[model samples]
Structure formats: C-alpha cells, structure tokens
Target: MTSCDRFLLDQPGGTLNHIRPVPAALFLAASLALTGCSQASSSEASSASEDATTSASAADFPVTIDAANGEVTLDSRPERIVSLSPSATEILFAIGAGDQVIAADEYSTYPAEAPTTDLSAYDPNVEAIAGYEPDLVVIANDTNGIVGALAKLDIPTIVNEAPATVEDGYDGVAALGMATGHVDETAEVVADMRAEVDEGLAAAPQDRLRIYHELDEKLYAASSHSFIGSVYDSLGATNVADAADKQKSGYPQLTEEAVIAADPELIVITDQVSYTADDVANRPGWENVSAVRNGNIVTVDADISSRWGPRLPQLIESIADAMASVKTPVG
Candidate 1:
C-alpha cells in the first residue's frame, strides 16, 4: 500500500509513533489524532442507482468500475448500501442516497441520519458485514483489503481511495456519485464545494503566510502533498513542515526545535487536546515563536479539518478567517 493508504487505515487511539511517519489515520477516519483506537462507525448512499431492477436494466445492472482494490461490478441498483468511510457516508447523504443506506461503519457520523453502528472499518469482520445483507459496500482501501475479503463472500465492494489534492477530492466524489447512481447530485456537490472554497480563499492575502497545521499535540504535521496541505496551498499558506528534509510521507513528525526554528506566523490546530496555546507559549525557548508571540494560534473543527469530504470548504473558510488575524510573513 502507498504511504497515503497506510495513513488512512491507522486509527487514532494510541500515542503517536514519533520514530516514523505515523499514519494519523485517526485524523482521516475520525476527527482527532488523540484517539488511538481504530473504531468503525456508520453508512450512507447516493442517488445514482435508482429503483431499477436487475432484469429491467441488465446493461446497467452490472455497472463495472475500477477502484482502489480492483474493478467492482454492481449487479443492480443497491437497495441496502454499507459505507465504511466517513467521507463516503457524507457524499452518499449529500447525493440523496441516504434512504438506501442500511448500515454504516462507526465513524460515518455526519448527517445525523446515517446508520451509525458498531461495525468496525479498521478490523472489518466479513461475517458481521455479511449479516447486513448489503448489496453494495463502500470502503477507503487502507492497509487491509476489506474489498478482497468481501469478494470471497460473493459481496460487491467499491474502494474510494483518499485524494491527494483538492481536485483529486472532486474526482473521488464524482466516482462515488457514479457508484451510487447519483451522478448529477455529485456534480452539484462538487460545484458547490468549488464555489465555497474559491470564495473562502479569495480573501487570503497575496503575500505568503507561513503556517503550521498541528495534526495532534505530538507535533505531527501535514506536508504540502497531503489533502489538508492542498487546502493550505490554496489559501497561499506556506507549510513550515515542508521545509524539513526528513519528511518523506505527507504526514511528518517535526522536532520541537525544527518548529521553533521555522517560526511560523500562523498555527492552525486541528484537534482539541490537553495541550493548548498556553502550552505552546510555555515551551522552553518557544516563547519567541511568531504564532505564539502574536497570539495567532487557532483551533479549527477537528472533524471537518481532518476529513477531505463535503466540509472541505468549511475548513478552508475557517482557516481563511484565522489567517485574517495574522500579518503577512516578512523575510
């Protein structure tokens, strides 16, 4: 699996492994990086596949599409859909497929109506999932091959891999639209997202602003290549973590000294932890950090900031609002 894939599968319940590129999977799957345990959640559906039967629409019956795991062919419009990814659940509900959704993995928490359950996405049990008698299953294609395992049970699965950039995120949304038979709604959702992001970022200053986006209190940062980094890139914020040569994977662990040296003028914290801006200010020798000194530390909604789904524009807007308080970085 790719580094990004590995990053998505890791759930956040334990201490971050500072030695390597910790997945921060918890950040993607759930909201906070502090939650070390990988928990499963709920599900959703999109509108593309309407109330069409297999015999009536044989040509469209087996809608085959290539996904992260491989190609999956849906025999007919799915009446019972199970979404393993939270982002997917949001897309499904946004695209008008919520009615068809029967069961969702634990983390699909948005829309309130999603069938959130005890189903674990991280350690997927084929028997438990099969018990739902779902005609279609959507996944995030992390370290484990949930798709492959489902195939053995003659179950149909589609893998919606995480996007690397904002544009890629649009594509992922559209692909989900097609899989769920909600093509038009997906397009509308994408257009709405683009407009919102464009509006959110339009207020960003032309001059670059160096920023440090904290994934957790452990100081793990998202490089310019990650999905969240792309949002920062859109708002013209330079990621201080990207300057470190030690970072290979998009999510990199930064040394306290490196962060202090970068002196980012803006700090965007993605989670609420015991550590606070006061903790940052009190760090020995970190008193001069531009963000801390200038009081530019901002805490964004952890769930929206972490997931690269429908709420991306909201995340962008929040970051932009935070940026308004800080002065442009000066050389």
Candidate 2:
C-alpha cells in the first residue's frame, strides 16, 4: 500500500506501527467519501461518466455547488463566483476557473491575479458577496453561518469543508472542477500532483526516522488522524504526536511529560518563534530530549505547512529538506 493510502486508513491509534504508508485500498476508501453515495448514484454518476467522454463541454448555465458543507446543486455555469477560503481560491485558479472568480476572501492572495473581493473583510461576508450577485458561492465547511445566509438569498453555493489529508486535497480540486465545469482539467492537475509526491517519496532514504511536529509553542501537535500528520507520514517520518488520540479535532496538546517520554529524534515547529536549541533544551523538563540535544529542531513555513492546497508539493519538499538535515551518529 502507498504511504498516502495508509495515512487515510489509520485510525486514532497511539502506536508507531500504524505509521507506515497507507495502502491503495485505504486510498480508495478515503476517496469514496468525497463523492457521496446518493449524489454519485443520481447526479454525478451519469454526469461524471458522460463528462469523461465529452471532456471539453462546459455546463449549459452558471451552476452553484455546495460540496463542502453538504451537496448542493446549481442550474448552470456560474459567471460570478465568490470564494470564501484561501484554499478554495487556490483550487479555482488551478482548475482553469479563475476567470469566474469575482471576489475572494481576505487570504486568497495566491496566483496574484485572483480578484481581491473582501467577503466579511476577514472571513466571509455573505452580504458583500451577495452584492456581487454571485451566480455561485464557494465556501469552506466551517463557514456554515455565511453559507446559511447566502442560501437565503437563493444563491447557488458550493462549500468545501476542511480537507483532512492530501487525498482530501485532491478531492477538493475535483469538487471545484465539477463546480467550475472543468472536470478534465481538474483530473489532469490531480494526476500531476500525485506523481510529483510519489517521486519525492521514492527518493527519500529508506531509514524511516521518528519526528515530533510542534504546531505551536503551547506543545499543541497533530496525530495520525490529522492531514498534517498524514503529510509527515508521506515524507517517510514517524509522528510521535500520534500518541495523543484523545482530541477529535486532529490537533491535541501534549504534556511536556509526554513529549519527554516519546523523545523523538527530530522536532519540527511550524511558526517562526525565536526558538533555539538551547530554548528547547531549557524547557522545564525537556533538557534531556535527543532532538534538543542534537539541535534537530526545525521551523517550517506555517502557511504552506498548515494549509492543504495546490502548494502541497512545495510543503512536502520543505519537510524532506528538514529531515535530510538531521545529524546521525557516526558509524
């Protein structure tokens, strides 16, 4: 089974044995959830199959889709589309649907050309978005309140909830494709992304190393159940944070005591906090940790590492570089 597939199947277990790459079977299972059974059988089954044959055809009219929060349907191709999340904005640009984007949320800064529409000014502004007369609304699942408000206006909206892993990221891309009437282009993009990730993994060293991913200075971290944890799995590293499976949100805080026990060889931090080897070593009881002693603590770009979007390949490579820099004992 591929590492990506294994990651999708792993439950909230606190063991390192479940840390291996995911099998193809698991990848299939994870993907199945993206296309709901009801929609797959009725609307998407025929449309997707037909779309495969006539790949170039666009939707007859502007259509609205709400795949993130739940499945929503639209009548035609939406001419004015508003994206409520940065990830959604990235997906639209990737699938050749950037032209339809009339407005985007505050953080949709990628691709440089995506229209700077301030929905809510910070998050999602249902009223400002409504002002654009968007034929379609692309929202994140977490933006339920805004989605509800837009629904009242009878605007066709597609919601992309948070993707838990890299596969979910691909599914988001495909979902955007269906919404923008560019399924073929979306499929192509996913294929290329999968291939790139595969190549990077193949080139990595065989000795799978132990890693601890620190989300914040508070000792908050991700487990096998989270997408960020899955990314660590893909890069051939074992996540020590997988030991804490109590939190359903995928991120859980670890006691400094628990971290000392796990004693991962490598420590990774996302934020650019002014932390040095001595800072980590001097932590209350973390003085003896191998990662701190060996100066293996590394900080990564939080935006790319945390956000599951089109730049995942870059994130993966950045992680690989960090792993490569770890110092090993001389033979």
Candidate 3:
C-alpha cells in the first residue's frame, strides 16, 4: 500500500475504507510487536540511567562545580571547608554543616565559632588555601580576584549568588543544603525562617506608610529591587523610592532635591552611615521634610541590615518598627 494508505489503515480515526481485512490484521499485529519492543528498550534504558545516578550518589565521587567558582569535590563528605563571606559562613552553620568548616574569613563572626581565615594571606592565597588543605571553599561574593586565582591553583570553590528577594533567600538555604549534604536540616531551617517572616507580616501595621532607606550621608538608597526594598514590600510599607526609575542597579543615589521632593515620612539609616535624623533635619532645605522634623529617622545595624544572611528576620522586624513609628506626612 502507498504511505498515505498505510497511514490511514494504521490510524484508528483515519480513512480505513480501502484496506483488506486480512492484511489489516497482519499489519496491526506486526505494529504491536514493534511497539512493544520499543517500549521495553526505552524502559530498560531509563532504568539503567536511574541506576547510574544512584550508584554515583552512593559512591560520593569527588565532583567540582565551575558555575559557583571552582569548588572542588571530595570523595565522600567534605571534612574541611573554608567560607569567604559572612553570609556563606552563616549558611554553613545553619545547615548543620558547621562541623565541616575549618576556617572562615575574618568577618565571618556569626555563630561564634568560625575559624578566622584571612583572605589577604592566601598566594594570591590560593596556595595558602591549599596549605589549609581545605576540601571546599564557599564564596559569597566574586568581586575579588579570588575566584580566578583559586581555579589556577586547582582548588574547588562554590560561589553563592546573593538572594535578591525573600524567596531567593529560601532557595539559597536549600542550595547550601544540597551542596553540603544537609538537605533535611536546611529545609527545617528554611521553613522556620519563612514562618517567622510570615508571622511578622501578619502582625505588622496595616497602613501603607511612606519609607525612605538611607544608606549613607550622600543619600544612597535601595531601589525597588534591593533586599531592603523586598523587606519593605513584604511588610506592606510603601517605599517612596519604589516609584523612582533607578530600580535596576539595586541601590541608587537620590539627590537632596529629590529627597526633599519625595519627603518620606520615615527615614532608615545604617549604623555605618554618618547621617542621622538630626543631620537630615539640619540640612539646608530638609528642615521642612516631615521625617526629619518629626524625628522618624532610625538607624539599623549595618551588618544585619546589609548582609543577606541568617539575620534577615531581625532586619524585617527593624523595618516594621520604623514603619510603625511613622506619624508624619512629607510634602
């Protein structure tokens, strides 16, 4: 039969008007046999693939990941780890992987037990990291030349991208869990954190108070895309800068003129910044700004507020308090 005729004969809903009954039965039996063989082959292949993955997981082969910077794989679990960022260090501890961390950057002060490892000391410090004989290094920031230098030294590094939003933070916890072989523990920690945040939001004031986050004396502020902006949005507070056009690059500077125009009801500053409520109030034209005049300026711990790590719940609470205290209207 022609291809079109064969196709019509094979299809249940197709034109079966021209087929001889005996020939059609024979063709259907052959087709069924071929289909059965194909399905059996596919099932075997799938089973084999699954077996391979299971064997790989059981063997715990040393694997390196280049996407997060050259993180080296070790046979079985890593016995020694070094963290390059405070956030990464915090994650390691949070996931019950703290026992694996042998060293940490000087600033990895949380949990009170991270070994102090100086980034400046490593040969470009890659050799020194080798001297520490670490099985893995967790990098939270890639701005420094460490990522490239570590690759040259054949060291394993895992670079963590900072979580830009609340959901991203939860995902980060899970990623750390998988990387450190502590998935169950990490899930528990994430669930607890999410519950805390949800409760904070539930109890937060209902009014959409205008908020201004001040990062420095020059009025550097977070855009709608920043971590702080995410916190404000979660708490139902209105970030005055949310409407600003510079929402792409994270934090952006707002001119004094613009600040005066926005006239936020609440101003939040980081401890590292020199500006305070009095400073803003004493500014040449800021005296009339409702936030300054009404003393609604609050300073937050820079490390907790700026770092996107385990202390995020505290950051959310601080923002909630600032918003709750807003009792002025900026013109």
- Using TM-score as the measure, the top candidate is 1
Against the correct fold, how does model 1 do in TM-score?
Answer: 0.79
Using TM-score as the measure, what is the rank order of every candidate, best first?
Answer: 1, 2, 3
Q: What is the lDDT of residue 213 in candidate 1?
A: 80
Task: Put the candidates in lDDT order, highest first.
Answer: 1, 2, 3
Q: Candidate 2 residues 137-177, lDDT tens each?
A: 77665443776787789986766665777877776666666
Q: Note the residue pairs that clash in candidate 3.
A: 68-159, 70-156, 70-157, 71-156, 71-157, 72-156, 122-125
Q: What is the C-alpha lDDT of each candidate?
A: 0.68, 0.65, 0.62
Give candidate 2's error at residue 257 in angstroms. Answer: 1.3
Q: What would the per-residue lDDT of candidate 1 be over residues 299-324, giving only the tens digit for each residue? A: 77766776777888888888888887
- Clashes (backbone N, CA, C under 3 Å), per candidate, total 19, 21, 7
Where is the poorest 10-residue window by lDDT in model 1? 11-20
